[model samples]
Target: MKKKIFLVSTAAALFLVACGINSGISSEQIGLRKASLENENKVVLADINYSAAQPGEASVYDRSYENAPPLIPHSTEDLLPITKDNNSCLSCHDKAIATDVGATPIPPTHYYDFRHNKSMGDVISDTRFNCTQCHVPQSDAKPIVGNTFKADFTNKDLLKKSNLIDVINEGVK
Candidate 1:
């Protein structure tokens, strides 16, 4: 038993030593850019410039992708801290009032309780009540690192060929 343990320990040590501590590769060879915060004494934070609420034709903003959370096209200056008794968003976004206010009503899915397997009547389900969890107001702040991401359906021809609603509801009965 002692000989088996000794041989196992020796083999493990030899394997680790053979792998060596360093690959001897420079940072530049792997194309690693310097971190944005490396030179900053204080933590570098982006200066968020909140966009003002735009009415009428100016209110529209293209969604990042089909079924992606639509960016809040208007300002959320003093309209936050959504509470049990006081949700400021419901004043305009509630299904009953949205059409009158010319605001988009919260989707039917928001009222559907997936866990309960039933449609919640009139009110936004508890799970979906906090709108900010999935939605964010757009800001004119530049990212510390550049984004190179491209949406899969950016091409107009490709987008036209696919029915987004059908794709989104593919598995639902």
Candidate 2:
């Protein structure tokens, strides 16, 4: 009985060794980039080309999904680096000025404090002040990985706009 068990274990080990040897994967072919795992110099990144349209001139992009943050369609070269003292986006995108400037208003969710569950009045919540954290400028670069996922929205309006404040607490007790 002992001899039979030893033979079976030895055969299994040898089979596993043979399978590993037959596996054609190498260290360079391991990841999606197809570059050497140990060397960073050989990896070449795809170029990112962002839209050069000025604010309020670029066409708006549809939301990627329900309540997904809207992408910045225009060049943000002048409006970036949102410091506490300076947020150029508010000049047009603030709730008060957006409509007048033909820009999408900053959603009500940006003004409400979720942690304390209270309105923050006209001021944007500290957590939501940094636009780039959730929103990014649209780019004309090819995707690293192919995406087959499609977004389905119950309301057609949600495809172009966010209703996050209205839907945030829907299922929550």
Candidate 3:
């Protein structure tokens, strides 16, 4: 029984070594590709070229599809940490003052409390209070990965058939 056990252990050890599993170095040391940002020289901590957007100067980006959340077209440097009582965004984005302030009005859908029986209300719903949750401020930073995504509007055939707004209003039926 002792000889049989020794033989089995020796065979296992031999098999591992034969399969090159005993290599002292990691798989990364054996020609594994490094991250896209990693380089042999010139270590970059962060994107140095990125700058904070100026107030009311941010360029509006086109939406990818119908009902897509519009990107914030201005700086939101001090307008954050939305609380129960305070929301700086509401000063200009609220329906009553948005047109006068030249800021886009918050969508009517934002007033509906979807979680609480989808009831409509006068004020922005609790679920939609934080504007930044769905809307992101545009930046000059380039994406790490190439995006091949194309919107439906780009297709000439679709445009010829009917306007995008008409199709969206008709629903998927």
The TM-score leader among the candidates is 2
Ranked candidates, highest TM-score first: 2, 1, 3
Please name the candidate that would achieve the greatest lDDT relative to the true structure. Answer: 2
Q: What is the TM-score of each predicted model, taking all chains together? A: 0.65, 0.82, 0.62
Residues 5-88, model 3: lDDT tens digits: 999999999998877866665544544233233344533444534226664555556665545677666777788777778998
Clashes of 2: 0
| lDDT (10s digit) by residue, model 1, range 108-172 | 77777878878898968999889988888878876656888767664555422333433556787
* lDDT by residue for model 2 (15-62), tens: 999998799777788888899899889899877889999986899898
Count the clashes in each prediction.
0, 0, 0
TM-score of 1: 0.65
- Report every candidate's CA lDDT: 0.71, 0.90, 0.66
Using lDDT as the yardstick, the better of models 1 and 3 is 1
Error of 2 at 36 (Å): 1.2
